[model samples]
Target: MTALYPLFADLDGRPVLIVGGGAVAERKTRALLHCGAAVRVGAPRLTRTLRAWAAEGRLAHLAEPYHEGWLESAWLVIAATDDRALNARVKAAADARRILANVVDDPALSSFQVPAIVDRAPLTIAISSGGAAPVLARRLRERLEALFDPALGALARLAGDHRAAIRTACPDHGARRRFYDWLHDGPVLAQLRAGEPAAAERTLRARLDGAGEESPPAHRLDWIDPCPADPGQLTLHQLRLLNEADVLVHDAGVGEAVLSLARRDADRHLLDAGERKDPGTLRDKILARCAGRGNTVALISQPA
Candidate 1:
């Protein structure tokens, strides 16, 4: 099996041609319409729902058999007809036009495969099996749907609303990341989930203005290894902390990819070999800075 690179396409107002008006085509059309695509369906016959849609002018109905010329204006094409020969012809025509096409139930003839999706408006999760084990992929999507709260969409919207202000207030990359982390896991999210959007917005504005709660006296210091070649190897907690750190004090040996995870505007201090030689001095220095600034400091080092 060929490895497929996963991607999300913006089909808004783009023409999509579906060669068939049967049940499969109807499903495809509904999905396309939900994404604001300009759908044009061609078939000798269509399902009652599809027929109704055509009558209502929701999509263009060819009311005839598929033709090669139909591929001309389409950004993407779908061959969902029951006839194998017709599907093959559709695939060939699409190939000649260098257009991306999917032949229903036939992965070998398809240039792309649609994955099972969990749509949360601005946030969508797509799970694919690379044209293998589709049912398993759907089951995984179901699990994810259950695990993720619907309120995430609201949270995303809230962030988007204040994005400019947040950027201006927290100019440093690290500080911005920390703000986002707090926004995601703090009381503001709880308020939003409780349907108190007004309260959430108020809290968000206050936090941005630095009028929020003071930091606790007991600060946390995370000793992390920055040698992982794959960023995926980092734990979710590690990833969150890296993104949320106010200060990142790292050994000189850390890789760029690991360091990149930290906020770009974060206060960075290099722990040279000589400084690292004195473990006691290094620990006191990190703690003293954290105490003085009341900022969260992350000490990144190789794992024992």
Candidate 2:
């Protein structure tokens, strides 16, 4: 069940205890420190950096091996000692206390497995294979590191800063999604990658400004009307219409393969109808911008 849960950051000052002084313990300690956890390490000795942290009083260290009492007050625990018996003892203690525990290279004793993490600042990607594959995970991370530009972290931060305004402007979930689609498209990302921060900010702000307009055309109300299209010729018309749309509002569909031919970065929406179908007035304004610039707007139905 924990497998599906996201790896949340330790930004809330969670207490983590690492029981070891070796290289594995050192690696885990560094990661926890980077996440801003208040870390306490229990080991008979320490590495150079661990000793420095203790000297600086940045983290607490116990000059001893695993003790049953160390389990108290720890939110998460890591057993990285070479001693198998001690690692097993620590795992049992953690299980009794319901604390998340990770034993280095020991799957059965672990309640949670740490992934090969990629940190691009503000953007963190964790890859885990349920302990079935660690080397594969590292290789995958390496591949992803090449694909995911470091600039994405900065863009993510910018998006975070403007989130409130974005929510207000693009009130509907669908519209808001479309805006993000536009955001990740070549132009905006290119500007950011080129170090044109002002241009990027201006582009995003302009999008927000456009989306917040009071009202728009009735045809713009919903990306796809509730009515389903007839098969055959309608599909062709849908395809052609998709090509003309500056913004394409599409839900999960069997026709996605067809739709992909339209525009590489065209805004696509996946609508789960429980939420607002149309994000809001602001989104319509962005679509209007596309239309004004002679961009086509297409709405494709979800695949059956």
Top model number, lDDT: 1
TM-score of 2: 0.69
Flag regions of model 1 displaced more than 4 Å.
211-221, 224-304
Q: Please give, for residues 159-199, the per-residue lDDT of candidate 2 as tens digits.
A: 89899999999886546756787887747778889999889
Against the true structure, whose TM-score is highest?
A: 1
| Residue-by-residue lDDT tens digits, candidate 1, 20-107 | 9899999999999999999999999999999998989889999887788889889999999999888989999999999999999688
Query: How many angstroms is residue 146 displaced in model 2 relative to the true structure, after the best TM-score fit?
Result: 0.5
Deviation in Å, model 1, residue 288 alpha carbon: 14
Which ranges of candidate 2 are over 4 A from the true structure? 1-6, 9-11, 212-304
TM-score of candidate 1 against the unseen true structure: 0.76
